[model samples]
Target: MESGERTLITLFEEIVNRFPHRVAITAGDQELRYRELDRRANAVARRLRESGTTDEAPVALFLPRGAELAVGLLGVLKAGAAYVPLDPDHPGDRITWTLKDTGASHVVTVPGYADLFAGSGVLPVLVGMDAEAEAPSLRGGPPGAEDLAYVIHTSGSTGLPKGVEIEHRHVVRLFDVTHPWFGFDEHDVWALFHSIAFDFSVWEFWGALLFGGRLVIMPKPVARSPRALHELLRVQGVTVLNQTASAFARLAAADDGAERPLTALRVVVFGGERLDVGRLRGWIARHGDAHPRLVNMYGITEATVHASHRPITAADLDAPGVSPIGFPLPDLVFHVLDEDGRPVAEGVAGELYLSGAGVARGYLGRTELTKERFVELADPTGGACRAYRTGDRVLALPDGDHVYLGRTDDQVKIRGYRVEPGEVEAVLLRAPEVSAAVVLAHSYGEDDVRLIAHVVSDEDPSVLAPRLGQLAAGLLPEHMRPSAYLVRTGLPLTPNGKVDKARMPAPTAETISAPVAEPDGTSAELTDTERRIALIWQAVLEVPRVGRDTDFFDLGGTSLSLLRMFQQVNSEFGTGLDITVLIEAASVAELAQRVEAARAVSPSAP
Candidate 1:
């Protein structure tokens, strides 16, 4: 085989041959050298084959991040079967979904996690990697480059997760593309910070297994704290580090610097979330010259792991704004397309679409969805060619770099106007003392769409309100500016670590500090009825801001919340308005008017 044209299995073989004595993985106090990992994987694979499993069979691995997870995955590959990684910490429903989705008949897990799928009808025959399992005879098996290696399920924020089936060729292509960035060698010790279930872990494993680099898996507790993580890196003599943006942000936010000396570190990579430019600069400054090379990688689960990475420099730190995600890595092709599927002009915002070797073979078991998103492109060659329609909105810069905008679905139509939540968030984050910002839309029955901004800051919203209005005027259209601004101490986060915008509080009039009246009286003012209704809205939505024009749903008030509001209004006013009336006139002002009308027409009253 040519030097660069090696599949994942072949790559692992090379590592066992050339660097057998080098340490490959570390879990707790246990260590597995490259030779040990290879030998054990071969033994496990031989056992699996003896059990009647073949190269195409699905083997499920429900282990946490550790040596066993690594060996188990490679063993499945060696047995000519695809491995499905299931995070033990994930909810049981999610795990069950994966099991049924993949039809996995065998599972490799420790004794403690064996019963997690007790009732699962397909009940994977549990295989133990402990000392008790027989160490079977090792045998070599050849798998073609196009054979499936693994299936990675995406974080199901929108719906049930779909598995992206990645082949060995995709893995080989990625290693070839990113090898030079980290300068992987037998001597390098790469810390595994991501969950084995995450696609990034696939990169970490392959980077080490192929290049002969040592993989050091940190304990679960240490992975949670920056100080503990820092100490582990230094103590373990880790040379390469990789973490998601949120993890890096916590590390950068910590006061302790020397806790993890960066002297031995050669490279630091961040992915899985949007990187905050200011936070990145702060991290670079704290580590100083001893800091390793910083890389911002961009990818989706549909793309094996990472499709592109750009090395950060001091000049990049000094420049304005967050850095562009940079160009695609070698063998990958990035295209920016307009709504009509035509190529977008330079510097124009468009939907980002990915093509080339990094793209996966489509969602496993979801033919309709797979065909919808992954379409055959116009490739001159007669062979198979595909492109993924990433719904991400981005602007293609003149330098061939791309600037990320918010998701296309997040765009809202407010007051007969179009609005992008990211534009609002950008303005809020740029505000003084604001550390983070999230914008969520609330909707009521009417055409009203209200924008609520959740900002993390100690600054008083009263003082921040007018200034924000001023800042927003220049940057946003009237409709896009949030009707209500809320200063939250912090935002919520989902399990996968991305910001939980869906859980953000609705914006109400209460959160905003009343602006001082201008002498010219140009500011919008509320009438007594408006004020009373706003108060009612604040009580109902549990938000501080409630403009008369704001939609009840737009205030984060759901139908359930509206129902409660109706009960409260009925109790306070002694009005006998039916629940149907409240549901019909969903807007606060409209519902208030209905209350007044009902009072005026009540029979046998007065």
Candidate 2:
């Protein structure tokens, strides 16, 4: 293939030919060299092709984080098909919805995750990685650059996940244009620290493989535990890391009093959420910005992971509380436009419209949404060009940089996931008793944000609230699930008869506490340990009070918030506790029990 005409498949094949002996991926104790990875993925491609999974076919990968995940992603592309990654960790309903929407004819999964497709309708042809590839070589050569590479699903404002159609060239040019800024090479080791369903993982995996680097697939347990993840980075010699700002905050705090610091990381790029520069003060004091340079990138999935980038240093800590996304890539341009689509003056806040090589091919099977979000405008050359309208409100700087303000709509980002409050509200409104529902996002800390749902119902709060909570848990993922569900007799409305979101009451102890009562209408008071734990939860969650039995997730606690809460609990109690403990023990009473159990075995136990 000509160098200028290379797609992801061709580019990756070139890398494989050049570095066949180099280790390409590491997951757990298993490692796959470029030669082995190529042979394996090629076999998968052959099998897919033999099974009639041809060009532009949407093959869904419903697998866990493993070498198989990479194999599936590459294999689909090698078969001239676009891969659709489905997070196994998400709610089953959501997974089913994605499968049906994408109309995937094949699924790349393992035996352990085979059950994920149980409720996904009649099921696609289940192609396991373990299946020996006895088929012939793929007939067609690699797909063209304009061919669809992947279809990533993003939460939609209309209560569904919209599949974004990204072409091979769009993603290839992302790194190609930014190569000068970051000289990634084979020597670097990167961590696949995000869910494959998330776009950040696209940057993580491709960034490593395209440059002949080693990519480590972080196990779910290790990914959730800050202590374990830090140790993994140190032991695995990870050099390039990608994280959401909130996740990095917990990681920095975990590194605070460590006997050994992570010195291998050379580039820590923060994306997925608006970075809070203030969170990096202590890390700067410890590591400085020389070795592992910090970068804050502003982007959305539609813009192919990142559009703008700025270095974050101690110098930024001195500036105002602003998130500065330095500038767009050389090939990408931004239009800070008013509601009427007119260009706004520099330094004036407006919705960010990104256009250029980074813009994807628009939403799959969503012509109306695609037209609404991705609009056409006159380019400098006088021809029409397409741009993706990011709902983010940004102030365009004279230097072509952008300072992120906030979102223009009700959508809010929680732990790097773009969540549409209306999606959650739509789920809540499914309950028969719910007359009206609104989901709101609130920040309990600088980086810790959570979702709160307010529902209008005539039913008793105690009986109806828990049902809504259970319903959301069954239908929504942990990040999208509301941390708290408040019951209201009636909703506040505006002059236009719309729910006056501005008038929605800020979450407080009494307002949030109205949702629950004992099944017998009698509750136990907080014990000393439970009270201490409650106090810590109250402080970390920024709530007035946390009862002994209050469910952590029901209180609007997210994985990031749980991490922050545990960091404090572990410090105060001098116990090594994993954040995953919340999975089984979420309430203050349950966590206190585990805390006491850990203390019993500790030398500090009295």
The candidate that wins on lDDT is 2
**What lDDT tens digits, residue by residue, belong to model 2 across residues 150-256?**
99998888888899999998899999887888899999899999999899998999999999999999998677656678889999999999999877876775676
lDDT score for residue 250 of model 1: 44
lDDT string for model 1 (226-305, tens) is 55676778888888888765556544444233433557888878776555454566666766533677887877778777
Error of 2 at 487 (Å): 0.8
CA RMSD per model (angstroms): 18.0, 4.1
Clashing residue pairs, candidate 2?
A: 483-554, 483-556
Candidate 2's TM-score reads: 0.90
For model 2, what is the error of residue 205's alpha carbon versus the real structure, in angstroms, after optimal superposition?
Answer: 0.5
- Per-candidate local distance difference test: 0.69, 0.82
Q: State the lDDT at 142 in candidate 1.
A: 70
Error of 2 at 10 (Å): 1.0
